[model samples]
Target: MGEERRGISRRGLIGGGAALGVGAAAVGFGAGRATAVETERAGAAAAYSLYGAHQPGIVTPVQDRLHFATFDVTTDSRAALVDMLRAWTDAAARMMHGDGAGPSGPTSGDYDAPPDDTGEAIDLPPSRLTLTFGFGASLFDDRFGLSGKRPAALDPLPHFPGDNLRPERSEGDLCVQACADDPQVAVHAIRNLARIGFGTVGMRWSQLGFGKTSTTTRDEATPRNLFGFKDGTMNVKSDDRDALADHVWVGEDADQPWMAGGSYLVARRITMTIETWDRQSLREQERVVGRTKSEGAPLSGGVERDQPDFERAGREGKPLVDPAAHVRIAHPDHNGGVQMLRRGYNFVDGSSDIGRMDAGLFFLAYVVDPATHFVPVQMRLATLDDMQEYVQHTGSGLFAIPPGVRRGEYVGQGLFSA
Candidate 1:
């Protein structure tokens, strides 16, 4: 109902003129085929609702592919920006339901006009797609008169030890994280959204990722990063309501009321020295990660799910889980009981000029507050984690993810409300 109201009556697909409209219709790919929305509602599989108390991607079950993009708002008109968001919201809702970005379908629009939906994902399943959006610190600048509403917690992340941040690939006025079981589907979502934004927003930087490195569901097995070591063994799960409330979801007393049900996102593009790491002995690798490479159990060990025993010592009377081990330093025991919902992905962008694979973990974490939940832990990891030897933080971002939307409401509507 909300989508119908906001979608369907939009005109162009690109350029300045089209950026002013905020509607996109949905359609079935072929004649007689049920629309994806209908098939999903029929229970062909589980589908995540676009309208909710919190966005879907954060806590939704991890998908197989990711297309994460950040954009620079080129328009100075607050009205134009707001309209673009509403358009994005409409497109996102339709796309998540396996419908096209616009109701005209990919080929049914006027012969002379550009098609609203990019036809790439035609006939593809929704693939459990989810689109999560956020606003960067720079968006609060005087450009749109939102200075006072900027949350103090939305401050830029401080530079950390061993950071080799590349300015060209970090930060933006807006961000959209598209994930789906099909890589093409994920890419399609981002492509259409970018197409819809056209002149109003320019793509700043983007990352394509595959093989989710972390999961938000307990039943799913933990996944390994590029280093071949299991990651996020202690991640907060979707069903852990208590943990979600305590660590991931923003509370009622947050500095900005607009972010009450939302969470903060810290994105770090960590590039690993694959060649160097591959040469390390198995024992050394396990020592650096503080877990058995194959099973992911702590060095002090019971099993993968058992709490790490940092105090346990070996025959040499040294801590079995090395003090500098990643698991040891990043453990909640060492970080004042803080935890985050990790939803990272592994990425490989071919090879570097030196002939080494230019790839690593595109780290994404959601927390109630970065100040207490992320910064300190990362600082410790930057200075103390043994994994730092092979990994370098290359690009980074901090975004304020607003709460979800109800039918007929745009994402981040709370921020614009008087």
Candidate 2:
């Protein structure tokens, strides 16, 4: 094989610097044996991670998945918050594309960069670390945060068919986001973030997004909800990095300070409607998924991977995943798969009469490559998915996330340069 898909490309990979660098880049710590480099930054504290495989991955037993959660912190003062965020990120000088050898540049912050075999402290590799800065809707009105409309690309596109959630624009104080699946990897990245004054973090609430029902695990062949039809039948798998790159990633050349690192961005929205779905019956509901509602087997049957028997349900020779059924609408060809990485949470917006309340999945997906992975999935649903009848995407927006700076740097460094 030319190279393992998971291996980092060496084209721009610089090597050889100092073995003692601390806080260099986050480590891909999957289990025990800490690959830690001590430093003055963020002192020391116990850290924990909740890593699970939703997709395939580099973690042992290799599966594609990501750690999903949301958190926040109130700064003693806005100025103090900004300064803290900046210093945490800019601790090291990121590797430029043209550098002959990857070596530790001058130490600039409270922590030292971690060293690769070359002893060089490198920047977080692309997709290795991602930051998305989203503002609270109210924060935009003030002078401190992004004002008015967001940039063109920092917006959410439809992830599922039958569009209900759409984006609305207004600036707000930003949410500091980061990603790395290994609990240690995630914790390391997070600790570096706190080293700057921005460390006082709190999660108002957060969870992986999908529907309220079904945990959405791979163990089940149906992959749909209790209704038995294929659900989330259209989603991104581990191999989709290239497919979503254009839409979700900030692909800068190595020349940019953070080239190998990802550019920060956002896609956020409020997803609603599980109650309407509950009212349907097993038989009627089966019609929507184009399969039997009891076993979650294809309408035609014969295990999940085998071609589902669509011909039995309709007049023409289509699989039971009816052209109009959510699955049929979402996966018309049977062979085609929709692409989207679903990481969302459930929340309460407010209430209505009868003691009823407004609450549902608050959805978000960061795309480094959108054209292939994100768009096609949404396009298919807009045209065919049966699942659309009960749900609607409600409110949404996009934001560009800046890359991590060496510990002492501010979060806005890349944004200003971009």
Candidate 3:
């Protein structure tokens, strides 16, 4: 694991100290050459470890772009599915390391044979690419004889109050979450994986997201969602090791041992009523969200990071934070101390017939158990939050993300091992 060897660049080999010394000795170079050398060294440095106790994308630094896809297992053969998983695992490792999908890359020089990689990301850096896989509830439905191995916590999500779900976009048998700083790099990873999965698994649904809606580190400025509110202000950051272990990571003695280091993933496509929200007054909007739009501070407020004083009163002894406010209902203190790692992204999928934007947040959350962490919190939000009137939950999915693989192993090998 010496940084996984994400392909050495030509600049790294030809412009380093030793290489520069040799070049200067052979042919004395000038200022322009020196500038070019420095420029090459200053190029993007983005790479993440592909092998670890848990998957990289969940807790890894939140990338700016996302390409999320879900697929159905078309082949009935268990062996065929396993084989495809192996292929996908290998391809993911190579892609994360900035290499091509297969052994022979795009420039294999064999014109007669098809190229393994699609050639889009040939000269691009890794961009901190992460490919995370998960198993949906349907995957355990007597198909591939995996019914017995399904985790008890992998139950399907219940319908919420303002849900207008589309069956076609809601669920799938398997899911692949690809995130990267560059949009093209994220797309390249998914395209190559889908190409490799042909004949075995076919994509059921997909979503493209840009401008991350949350921040997972203290150094990162809190990002805004479609509603223009600072999102994930109290999120479980990578530095919060204790919070991650307690709220995000699965325990050692869990329902399924194979999923010890893994966590449950919940994906929701919330469509915003943009026209309606646009007409609302600033006071009404702030009251609904329970925070100041400018500073993102709680209405009971001091500053952005100040703990919300829920009991504080304002005019005529009225509660300062609205009882039905989004922040009030979704606060961890009110939800039995339950918190999720939110890494969502804002998305816009064109427009409807009336020209209203078909857009909202593609919410992604990782929790130790959705039953305890997500279900209760969402249940409260769906019923009590005043913000529900301005948004609709159009798509939903739940998956069991397995533990990460070792260098020589596949993604879900532990489950397959007898």
Each candidate structure's TM-score, on Cα atoms with residue i matched to residue i, is 0.90, 0.49, 0.90
- Candidate 1 deviates by what RMSD? 7.7
Error of 3 at 344 (Å): 0.4
Candidate 1 TM-score, C-alpha based? 0.90
Report how far off residue 51 is in candidate 2 (Å).
Answer: 15
Number of the top-ranking candidate, with lDDT as the measure:
1
Q: Give the C-alpha lDDT of model 1.
A: 0.85
Off by over 4 Å in 3: 1-43
The segments of candidate 2 whose C-alpha lies over 4 angstroms from its true place after superposition are 1-84, 87-152, 155-173, 176-234, 239-248, 253-271, 290-319, 332-338, 347-351, 355-357, 369-386, 402-412
Q: Cα lDDT for residue 40, model 3?
A: 19
- Whole-model Cα lDDT of every candidate shown, in order: 0.85, 0.39, 0.83
Writing each residue's lDDT as its tens digit, candidate 3 over 1-418 gives 2223243332233334243233232222231221011111122434555677788798777899999999999988889899999999999887876677887677553556667788788767677788999999899887788888899888888877888999888889999999998898899999999999999999999999998987888997888887788988888887787888899989899878889988999999999987899899989999999998888999997998888999999978989999999999999999999989999999999999998999999999999999999999999999999999998999998999998777799998888788
